[model samples]
Target: MNLRIFGWSYAVTAASLVVALLYGGWEALILCAVLGILEVSLSFDNAVVNATVLERMSEFWQKIFLTIGILIAVFGMRLVFPLLIVGITADLNPVEAVTLALERRPEDDPTSYAYLLNEAYPQIAAFGGMFLLMLFLDWVFTEREHTWLSWVERPLARIGQLNRISVVIAIVALVLLATFLADEPTVVLIAGSLGLITYLAVNGLGDFFEQAGQKQLEAFEEEDAAGPRNGSGPSQLAKATGKAGFFLFLYLEVLDAAFSFDGVIGAFAITTDPIIIALGLGLIGAMFVRSLTVFLVRKGTLADYVYLEHGAHWAIGALAAILLVGIGYHVNEVVTGLVGVAFILSALASSILRNRRLAAQGVETRKTADELAADHTSV
Candidate 1:
């Protein structure tokens, strides 16, 4: 509740809105504000997932995530990525893509540049949807002592005992999505497969480095125990560093990209002006999300609210479902966003009730350092 962390986000929002007004006139300003709300409704759970991973990083890397990572999230995903997609899909060079985007508006004409850009939606949905599905599957399948939606999650976790079941389920879902409903079935299948591969590579690499860091921590601890000991153990020891930190950082970017896939496409419905979209969604919405993520980490919110992370993954799962379904049909953006919000809010309410019940019973629920720390000799 300090509110100080969001100072930079507020400044950027003002500046971005001012640019929207001056360049785009009052209508642009209005759309900018509208897009901010849209982006938030679409991506707040993205921030929560980010916090779970980012809280483990060193302070220096955390700064890198905010600075360099913001640039990637804003410009890389919001701007360059769209352009890149158009270029590849339309077989246009980069300059031609930029020229087309500058010349034509989709809101007005059927054969406009924006039309070409919008045509790439199915591929985008496939890639982002599969990636997120993998993330949700892995999390739910991994057995954990604590769970928020036990009836649902516990059953999924039990199924996880079958090795690589998450991958199997994801593949089945992808096949169903592509073969049954998608217009460009082959293209969506390839895109979704790439998404699955990307998730496996990044998650596998991050986990490997995380285990190495944990081993290093364990070595330090054993050394500490052999010699003179402080009453406290090495509580401050880093769970992830060096390569582990880099891979985790990479994972965060992929997660952001996946989360933004639909949000970026959804912005087209409001305006085809890429600049305004970046300013509204990237500069304003994403900036606030990053700040909120840091706030959650610094405040120890996740540790206190045990169900929050579970809620986020559940929201992610819902978002993935929406994206996959959207390939065959147009799903309302509000519906997509609200499904995520509902899951998160319900999870938060459950966490509060659980906390109160534990307090009355003289029981505790805060995650032990080890529980939160797994992934390194576990963060």
Candidate 2:
């Protein structure tokens, strides 16, 4: 085995084990192992999909993803995010809320939070319904063009300037629904607002960082051009374009979160032990994601698997809809799995058909070429 890969894996796994050991002892350790396995299994498709985006990122960005990305995944999502949700929804003090989650005994009923949220079924349905509608529209509008279902890109391409405004409007609409329709309007508003704010804040920061990265790339390219004699070098401007590439990297992580929403919620259905959830799902899932990233980088899998990215985006879109449902309506884990599995299976089938068609076309071209060559030789 490659020691470097081994070292990286061991480090993450060991850190998880140590954390579990410190917090809850042998039971925690068992929980960590089981969760890790569950995460790995559930997220294989996630890893494959993430690798599609990660492969397009720069080496420095890739390093940042492994280091900083893991921190965000753990602390931001696993530790703090859920607590933040509970605080806003339950009106519990943030620290106290988190402590409740961390220290709540398994023997005692832990269904209060889950039940509180589940009661708002109509609101959940509205959120999920609208979200699902948007997803369907996006797929129909964007994908129809690719499939040649229509001669032109429809209303989406034509409605150019209102795009950002439309997103803002959607946010406002969600805010209205959460505030007016939810049982605890303030809690719902806070929770919904946090998500929107988090998205915008992270997106804005990522944009700024990416811009700075572009400037650095330009400077580096200029230095390289001036210092070394090389043929057909990529220009400073081209290098600068890589700044945008970094934004794409950030987009992938955001996309990953969107994809994980249902899985995270579903994990709650299994067990609500925060530490156990973190150990079982977060760390282990992250390990597999890291491994998938390395595998994609090493094997150039993204280049080889043409339609895999398409499949992943479809999965992301589906998960986004499911999350909207989770906001108000209860989604079963079985349904989540079935939906994801169905989309993946369909994508795989499409890929096989596409590959076979291409192969047939290639064979036909080769046959024609051979016939022409034989005629020329006879002449």
lDDT of 1 by residue, 178-265 (tens): 9998998999999999999999998889878777877868877787789965644454344355777788889899999999988888
Q: What is the TM-score of each candidate against the true structure?
A: 0.93, 0.65
Q: 98-180 in candidate 2: lDDT tens per residue?
A: 66776654523444544333343333334333443343333333322123112333454355234454355546656676665
Count of backbone clashes, every candidate in sequence: 4, 2
RMSD of 2: 9.5
- List the pairs of residues colliding in candidate 1: 214-376, 214-377, 373-378, 373-379
At residue 327, give the lDDT of candidate 1.
81
What is the C-alpha local distance difference test score of each model?
0.85, 0.56
Give the residue spans of candidate 2 off by over 4 A. 1-34, 41-45, 87-98, 106-181, 184-253, 363-379
Candidate 2 lDDT at 243 equals 59
lDDT of 1 at 102: 77
Error of 2 at 250 (Å): 4.7
